[model samples]
Target: MNTLFTVSVRRISHVCTLKPYKETKWLMPYGNPTGIYVYNCVANQRVPVILSDPHIATWYSCGPTVYDSAHIGHASCYVKLDIIQRILKSFFNVNLVTAMGITDIDDKIIKRGLETNTHFTNIAKQYESEFWLDMNSLNIEKPLIITRVSEQIDCIASFVKKLIDSELAYVSKTGSVYFDTSKFPSYGKLSRMQDEGEPSDEEKKNKMDFAVWKGHKPGEPYWDVPWGSGRPGWHIECSAMVSKVFGSQLDFHAGGIDLRFPHHENEEAQSCAYHNSRQWANYWIHVGHLQVKGDTKMSKSLKNTISIPELLKTYSADTFRMACLTSNYRYSMEYTDAAMENAEEVLNKFKFFLKDAIVYINNNTATHPCQYKDSILKELQKVQDGNIEALKTDFDTATCINNMLNLISSTNKIIKNDSSGYYPVTVTLIVEYITGVLTKFGLKLQDGSQENIFSDMLIDTLVEFRHTVRLNALSKKDKELLNACDIVRDKMKSIKVQINDSNKTPSWVLIK
Candidate 1:
């Protein structure tokens, strides 16, 4: 019975919208294109992504309160979403319009402001700037719309008035306005919390009724509203801003897994009531927590959260991203030093594999074309199909990442043992394809160590240092010494110096 109802809700959700995706030249559907699928938490299953228009979709992500620096928890959610967003736009050919709210007027910000002797907006601005830096560092795409709660007070107030006028909400004697949850029969549908009929406070008609507008109080901000001077409720902030921007139905609503309860449930309820529709958002995509110390979630109140800047200080952005994608987006990921170290090693494997392939391509002038083009093509096909298949199963990046590692290992076997000469450029095709996929996954690739700890000239120094040492090691025939030189060469990188040595040496002069 529960499954039936859930299925019905999902079907009706898409009905609220109009058209769907296509196979070819968007306007006129041609062949059968692969329909995108996402795990809709509300439906408790994987469902086809739908939009009113086949070419465009709408998404609204619940962003941070901007009271402090963003942490790994935040990175885990936004970065994963960014990867999915890029795939949808580039591969799926969907023009996604995304919006994220900056919760500048939350109680957390107010408390932080008072504690730091700063105004709430000032605190919001400071951290918001830092938040942008973190997002850029992670290569998160900027949302098409950025709505701030402080700037949307008028719109929120207008939404509240409409709800009150429609009897879906009521203004309390304290001048606060609350959404009457009793009027919305499906209030607990999303969260699955048992319905309650407990007695309410003097201000609420029902205990479950949540505030839509908070009355004016000392030491807090206020805005003029029909129900006296008050501020928008935390739950109403998203509904109002999203509705003002996208109107009635949305293709997707996303946030962290923790938001599924009161925050998201409340937001969904009010949006449904205000829009006078059974379903306001088609899909609820909630990302899992980034935990630490065995299921202890990283959070501000927990004091165990690792900030983005701090994590970036030790690891590259790509490494951190790999750590987050190590598990399914729906599963909680533990952040430990070992986990980060593993991610770094995996990243090194990818870079070293590409570097070796490129070097082979450059040095094959005297050799005949690779004897096994068909076998090489088979491997390339596996990578291409594996990547697409992985993404198809609800953005199963964990599977995709694993497949990539396995492919690298398999491809290495051909490179190492195969004695037959092949066109060096054959492997170059594989390198380019892998790099393209990496870009789609929102990763920045560079030769050598991804670290920027040393200057560009230093890469030249290391490469030259190793090259000068190479001849001595060959005479000595020291396996360990040769391996160490290989390591140094792989770690050396300089963009300014155009290095095309048949022996993989930097030939151009240093810019400085």
Candidate 2:
């Protein structure tokens, strides 16, 4: 008998250390006080998330089949799922344990090996490394447990044996093993797929039945088992990994919408049959497809798919994330150059606003008790409330982003008016709040590392030189000196730097 696995949880003293600004009249609850709702694909309804343990949550996502380089289509699914995890951690303060499975020994990997005359293991490792590089480039959070199908063959074999002993599966004439779908009446509960007329192949007993283990073929990898010598089937691999890592039940199961049919449905059926529990997962979340601009799905055969490495070459990770956030996670988004360009523009605007605010706070030391503080605080509270509310309702990142934009606009308006005194404390709080929220979305203010000390000194020296030149020009009314100042401004702009001349001292901000 196989022992069920249980997750160990440790009590964390502080999940979030950032405090809200001055504890306003509006108190935004951190935990799921009102019950967070998530869209469940099995029920086809938005269901409230009921956690098995209040302090910890367990979730799983289907990972890549390491046959080739991962494309943007894969990136979209992972990034969206990362956002979901971030929301749970940042907003709900839940300790999360997430797992993803890698199919390293799939049919596709075998085919690639034959075509290239290379070892399948070498190919799997090459692409797996590339996949991690691309994931890092996109700033995706790493899963706690990344199980490869190759490493779980023994477990998979044991699981297949259990089904066989129970007569839920059988050994075929070809020495292969197949799942007897007839034994499980709720086989199509997840996919809602109906049986076709007849068995497609004469060798199989039923058309609905799928392979649990394949017989060994010529020049293919195989493992010795009691009944046969072959590899585990695609569906059995995931089920086995989940069983070993997370046991029978999962808090959430997420992947692209394309996996809903045969891939995820089969896994669910086998898990339910083996564990004898109808509730395999509490919530099944599926992200929409990332389509090409012309309404065609991205596919390798179409030769129109964009790889993550190629995308990062042209755009920053935050830019790509921002483009994904522009649409709802449950709706399809078109990948066009125009869409990415628009995202970049929005990101630049945010950087500029943040730079200006930081500069104003640094230069001005006088704290003015502004008449507009009460009004601004009220508006900020409303925006914060809207952001929290949007995320609570199925993690609507688009709406949350809209609320952040509103907050930015309000901040800009207050700063634009000279009559309203600059409240340093209030501005600091707003900046903290904005950056905190943006970080949760996997976006940061600066793209790369900060400027080195020497580079910073060079910039300061140049700014001081321009200031001296401008002063001389004003005192002596010299056109040449003024023209030299213009030269400095143009030079800075060419290097993607913006100079602010409104303050007593000239300050520069780098534009990523």
**Which candidate number would show the highest lDDT if scored against the true structure?**
2
In Å, residue 283's CA in model 2 sits off its true spot by: 1.3
Candidate 2 collision pairs: none
Residue-by-residue lDDT tens digits, candidate 1, 178-256: 8988787767767766446774587888878889999999879888776699788889999999999999878778999
Give the per-residue lDDT digits (tens) of candidate 2, residues 1-512.
11111112221112223222122111111223336877766555565665656668888999999999999988988999999899898788789999999999989999999999999999999999999999988889999999999999999999999999988889988778988877766666666776556877665777888898998998999999999799999988988999999997777888998888888878877887777655566678889988996678887878988998789899988898988777788878889999889989877777777666666545445443332265766776787888887888899988877777777787887666666676543554466567668887888556579531124544564566567557767889988757756755765675466777742677889885
The segments of candidate 1 whose C-alpha lies over 4 angstroms from its true place after superposition are 1-34, 447-512
TM-score of each: 0.81, 0.80
Model 2 ranges off by over 4 Å: 1-34, 365-372, 451-512
In lDDT terms, how accurate is model 2? 0.76
How does model 1 fare in lDDT? 0.74
Deviation of model 2 at 269, angstroms: 0.3
RMSD in order of candidates: 10.2, 12.8
